[model samples]
Target: MTDAELPEDLARLWRRPTGSGSRLGRPAGLDVERVVRTAVAMADAHGLAGVTLPKIGETLGVTGMSLYRYVGSKDELLILMGDSAFAVEYIDAGAAGSWNEGLQRWARGLWRAYQEHRWLADLPTSSPPRGPNAMAWMDAGLRAMRPLPLDRMTKVGILTLVSGYVNTSARMAQQLEQGWRQSGGVDPALAAQRYGREMARLVTPDRYPDAAELFSSGTFDTAAAPATATPVDPAEANFIFGLEVLIRGIEATTASAALDTH
Candidate 1:
């Protein structure tokens, strides 16, 4: 089924906070589930901007200040929201195959996850993945590649490449989707034409001759690509381009590691 039609169980997952042991982190009666649920629904309807502690309070029939009692500020809520939305439940107990194959599957699943929840792309990578969900995801990724004969540093490098690609591609797709919806379903060709016009106005051939000629020829189709198409397909050309880069980077890393060992 499409992500929009994801089962309630799956969708509500984003609202569930990580366990705080037997001791309650806050007052005895905070309904984290309700807060997250309301926030997720709001985000689905109005992008990330729609999510506010007060707005969520309204959704749950509580005052805005009531929310701060359970969660901290909006930033803290966002951290929780991000974790809930992107949390990992189970690292495939049945994961099977060569380490590289396993890694590729993990990466692809992450890419799909971001696609399913477009907001994942919107979440900033300000610091390393600290939230429980993100950490769980990172731990799973390292576990998947645990069989590889590489040092911790190499593993970190690989993680960087994979994570960067996922974040960049998913976000680009989100922006494109937002624009499409905002423009009331813009024409792909016309949108490209407009971008070309804008570039023409901003870009001068004398300074950027090659860029001007490239856009002027209309051979380079930015509108058809991820940057403009709201919710563009993850299987688009750029996605593939990124995948190729990941594969090549992996191959290169493996070779380099082998050489270092030898």
Candidate 2:
């Protein structure tokens, strides 16, 4: 469809091909892709809040108002940034041996994208993603679930759940790492154990029985003092643990669906 047919916000997203088109009388080197890339870089180095049109223009050696010819406003630029951040080439989800393997690969691919662009987790989901790259991500997830007996909505639901899990998990990890760096960059295991130890003092069984039990179980202590140095990084280990749990849930749902059809 042409840009004219879509809503204003969505039209802006699908309007110009990346780096291919420029407005008349625009600067020699500046284009949509370059501007978005510059903003993405700013977010990567500083943060999402650090990316302003004026800052990007200054980096590109132009006036901020001149950028209006390309992107309409800051909100529109954010939409571009959200789409641009996920510009990684996704693995073909249907190629895997099973839906389980296919989805794991898809989820990991998305996770890697988030890791590369930490600011991505901070971008608010103003509306359903309509950009080419964003739609491609959803398409990949649906492809992975194509073998399942479930219907379209079920597949979409699974994708939404997995996507939310990866985004929130990445955000938490990023926040924790930043906090750790700010607080002397202690070992993560040590950090976990210290938090547990401190919580143990304030939390009581009367008010928080489950939490008290968990704190008293010495789980954090074991993590802090593993028997041998393991090759797996703790952050990745936690990620895989949660990912496998979601995969198992999806597999169970598929199994149920198959049984129902029999």
Candidate 3:
């Protein structure tokens, strides 16, 4: 479906209480879950900076104070919502063939989660994830890497790298997607055409024979094809590149330890 017909990403973030108790002194059917659900939708629509309990309540047709009966302060709701979003994702430990594959899967899953809840990246890093759902996702990542030869510190390092990759990549992708959407979606092919035209007029074909030939070969067209906010895994290639260097370093360290022992 076109963007016009697509489902509102905001619906999952907030909704009004279903019954009449909202008119009473107490929120009749409201609870923390409903509050969080609504808050997520509001944030999804307007960004994390936009979601205040009062604003959420207004969206829900309830007074802001009434929401406190179920959810604590706005800070409390944010913690719960971040953890809840993390809770919905889990790694399939059995599906992958090795630690690297498992790590890649874990990275991809977390990436998808962040994309779905773009505000997730904005979750207060100071809190450090106390909620059960958040801890569970952390545990799942640990479990996926449990069989690797790496020690606890290495596990932490690898997971850190994976998490960093997901968060950083998703944030970049989100920014690009948002900017493109705001500009009616950039065309990758148009980028290639623009580059080719600009270069042909500036550089002499004789002086830059190799560059000119490369441009003429249409390789830029192929490379730019997936640059239009495609969700394809450029990460796989990047991960493989980084992994090779990391693995080689680890092996060198391991070999030195073996030699020292011998």
Candidate 4:
């Protein structure tokens, strides 16, 4: 779509009254928020691909064409739904003690939301967030970093990195969980063991010494999993590790910047 379409879509999502004569005399049975909420429910129940205008209209007891009165298009509907789905009070930076603590809380909250709404990771982000809730979440993230010695753009970039990691981690976890479910509820630990044995039988140490050594190191052994694993969810330990590493990088960068200014 052209850049010209973005403003119109944002207007539709924010429910700003279009002064156009086409929308001046609209009926009141449906509203933008309700339409967006319904669309979100549809997406949550199914996946993003399953959320079509016709399906949303059917669920709302209206014809597909009627939904256009509230939402400009399916693209507009998706923007609204994504904003609404993330419309939650996940953290309070003011009471979070320190910037690091607040940011950790923020990241964890976002991770939980992505887990609960698995389809959110599938939503197209070609456009920047314009809806109220989306902007609010962004504001919260910035607020969490208020005590940091970073520039505004740097802080925003930090949030982007944190959110990107959360989305990727959540998507991977979702795929793994779905695969496990598809395999008739096989325990992940058992699956790992079976895959390791198969790899051992297939891979030869002569040509692929690294692979063979990794396979022999018992790193894949879930039976000997660490007790102090981060995130408490074995499937999400990597996410925790990556989050901590990213936070440390940010701290180092900001600290260097501070020292340079002195």
Best by lDDT: 2
The digit string of per-residue lDDT tens for model 4 on 117-220 reads 78988777877667777788888888888898778988888888888889888888888889989999997777888888778777779979999987776667
lDDT of each: 0.69, 0.83, 0.66, 0.79
Worst 10 residues of 1 by lDDT: 16-25
Single out the weakest 10-residue window by summed lDDT for candidate 4.
Answer: 222-231
Over 140-248, each residue of candidate 1 has an lDDT whose tens digit, in order, gives 7788789878878778778888878877877787678678779988776667777887897788889999898877776546545556546754345577677767777
C-alpha TM-score for every candidate? 0.70, 0.89, 0.67, 0.88
Worst 10 residues of 2 by lDDT: 14-23
Ranking by lDDT: 2, 4, 1, 3
Model 2 TM-score is 0.89
Task: Return the top candidate by TM-score.
Answer: 2
* Residues 60-158 of candidate 3: C-alpha lDDT, one tens digit per residue: 889888876665467767776776676544445467776556666676677667867888877766544455665666777777766666578776776
Candidate 4 deviant stretches above 4 angstroms: 1-6, 21-27, 92-94, 222-232
- TM-score, candidate number 1: 0.70
RMSD after Cα superposition, model 4:
3.7
Model 2 ranges with Cα > 4 A deviation: 1-3, 15-24, 90-94, 226-231
